[model samples]
Target: MNVDGALAPAVESILRTARERTPGEDAERISVDARSFSDALADAEENGRVPLIAEVKPTSPTTNGERTDDPVELAETMVENGATALSVLTEPEHFGGSTENLRRIREAVDVPVLRKDFIVREEQLDAVAADLVLLIVRFVDDLEGLLSAAEERGFQVLVEVHDEEELREALDAGATIIGVNNRDLARLEVDLGTFESVAPVVPEDTTLVAESGITTTADVERMCDAGADALLVGSAIMDGDVGENTRRLVNA
Candidate 1:
């Protein structure tokens, strides 16, 4: 289902909370142990395949129903099924995820965990035991500063982009991991060719992560063939047996 304007209000609320919070008082801070998300992806390659960062989002505006139970169980299953890394949604309102999910998933699995959210404040970054954080290049004003800040706090950055201009901004900000989101925010439609189009301009040394709209082994192979170093898949993997679904992605 299309959710073109659905994301707007949720994002605005989070950004507002980020702006209103005082330093070291975010109340959302959970754990402080750090892991290297970039290194884990580099280690997940097998037969020259792209690594998988299996995500643990309970729900999203694009889909219906909620996954309020067994998030940790699902997370462990993904890790057990050869997940290179883990992505736990920390955005509460729209995604129905909590920092508790991130912290416990980190403790539950040894793999790197990425706090996937629309982060706008340093305090927000301090709220997880996450190895890395998703810094959407579209929402952040100082991409370079946020990149540096996350690195300084022991977390790597996944700079997400939806178009060429945002891709350039991520590159210009010295981002080591760049995520090409296929879902167009304005139209709320996914186009895999988005990654095919934007990936060529990215340098080989950078880890190119493909996000959203992938559902099958064919999609996985297509992304791998298109030069995605890693894939961040959530909804599809959540829709079936976690282990089998993840293995399909890894083998693809």
Candidate 2:
């Protein structure tokens, strides 16, 4: 596969990280007890409320360092404040995240943890024991194969997309859970309309997650109104009181 699609610099950095890992280390095996991430998300809403999958990214290419000094503490606070699941950034370089963060956060919370990283190889999948994993459609050459591999590794897939074509591609690749990233990979620009525009085309059976640019209660409501089952928020929640910000979104 040519993998000729134009990748954003942040994603390119992730691919570089994957390529740099030692051979067997990339494929190093792990055995974790099965936790149904699909069900965890599906059951998150018990009283007609949208679930909030709060994130623990230390930083991003756009945002250099994290506000939270203790990621595990922040993760615990989120769950205690009604977070349905957790999204932990495991990308070390640009994001300032590490597998150590995911491991600690996962142990602190019973809710499913999403291993959010630029996953390009099967070995990357084996490195984390999180219950869920992210798979960006534009970032990989074989979407179906990676989705299947994640499932085989006992993790639910959060297949991300930015447009109609990518949505269709994800569906065709058997993506049961789809997240519409508001930020365009090419320009690294955000517009929540990305979710509104592509949502109607999504099947009712597939779980829909809204990622990025969701900062306020209104933002949460907007995403819910646009048919999102959940929201994957990081920066906004991490910027202030984790509990308060999380509860605000949860109440939204």
Candidate 3:
């Protein structure tokens, strides 16, 4: 079966599983703080280096299997190398990740953690304990309501766009952090030029992040040349020596 085609159902199942795992009282009392993810990135940028958001992803829809199941160790290695933040993939079925992994990774590292998933509903956001939230432009037709609700809940939104129209909608929705994902959601293909197409349209002050298909120091340099303030890398670090590769990417 094509896993990408079943992504929506798989995500729904994961959310239901997360809700089932949480106790009634714990779920009711759980609250995210007022601090946003942007605060962490801003602080890092002020120190004169690009923020590196390293990911602890066990698997992906494209990969179709686990790259690594040890979340805590991976989180530690990322931090030890020079990652400014952590991105924990919480989508269970498609990504081979879970909320338990996210909570464990957060406890394992001190850096801010972003919940990287196809965030489509508010209740889904509450299911995972994340310092930052992601919003995919291709996933939703209405942007205004979603952006407003996310901000109201004290979550920093990383609005992800693959095309110019999506970029425009993200800015209109008041997205402070704009991520240009090179991976096309419709075809599940990656094109590095996607960043080149969208980066210029983003405001100078907005934190620009290049996501997907980045693997080497050369890729990092290319992204930096294209005006990216941060980069989200997963497979390369997960499959290689995490600490060594992370240091090369961050210090590049």
Candidate 4:
């Protein structure tokens, strides 16, 4: 339930902007039509490899020193390097990203795009305008309601968890796609062992995604061996040669 104090102010700004932009009529209008998460997984499986959800992150609260000013070029580079899906960080201030970046990236890429942010409320969902939505278990107080709202909006949800209890909560909320984040959000530390520790608890039917601290073929191989169906990589890809890194990680 704990989150970075800095993120609170950033989330407030995002919510305020979203409220100002959304009209009363549009706010009430519900669009239940969208692309399926199953389709994205199927495409990844058909390719005979785990789906790579490459991220276009400008900055991170944990890694405040590192930042990328250009999201459009980052998104284009990720797509060109054979990324099955694009994950764009839309939480500005803390992560230095915006929905504008996601919208722009979605417009530029043919692949499905995921809005990677700390999803707190239903109103925040409307602002993303992405095919997929990421909901962190630690941050969400109403897991079921968020999942239901995401489903109603026609956006696939990637329920993120760092521990057994959170993982169970995600499943109980009917999350078909689950991401085991290796990074400890509270302490801002990375532990590769988190995946191994939580692998046994993942249900057989759910598509598992390994998030954070993945940098090499060995890391991908390790996660794949532990039953990860896909990998959501960000800093590693963003900071290095994306094309070569993509070929190495995906082909590995």
In order of appearance, the predictions have TM-scores of 0.88, 0.92, 0.85, 0.86
State the lDDT of candidate 1 residue by residue for 1-252, as single tens digits.
112244555455665664554425546544445676666766776345459999998898787787766899999988888889989988777788888888788888898888888787666677666788889877777888888888887777889998788888888889988999998776567999999999999999998999999998999989988998889999988876888988888777
lDDT of all predictions: 0.81, 0.84, 0.77, 0.78
**CA lDDT for candidate 1:** 0.81
| Per-residue lDDT over 1-252 for candidate 4, one digit per residue giving the tens place of the 0 to 100 score | 434343444445544453344323555534644456567768868987557889888777555465555788878877776777889987765677888898888888878888887777777687757888898876777889989998888888899998898888899889988999898754557898999899898889888889999988889889888888889998878776776777667777
- Please list all clashing residue pairs in model 1, or write none if there are none: none
Best by lDDT: 2
Q: Worst ten-residue run, lDDT, model 3? A: 1-10
RMSD of 4: 3.7
Clashes of 2: 0
Model 3 residue 14 CA deviation (Å) reads 11
Q: Please list the residue runs of candidate 1 whose C-alpha ends up more than 4 Å from where it truly belongs after superposition.
A: 1-33, 47-50
Candidate 1, residue 139: Cα displacement in angstroms equals 0.5
Better of 2 and 4 by TM-score: 2
Superpose all Cα atoms of candidate 2 onto the true structure and report the RMSD in Å to 1 decimal.
2.2
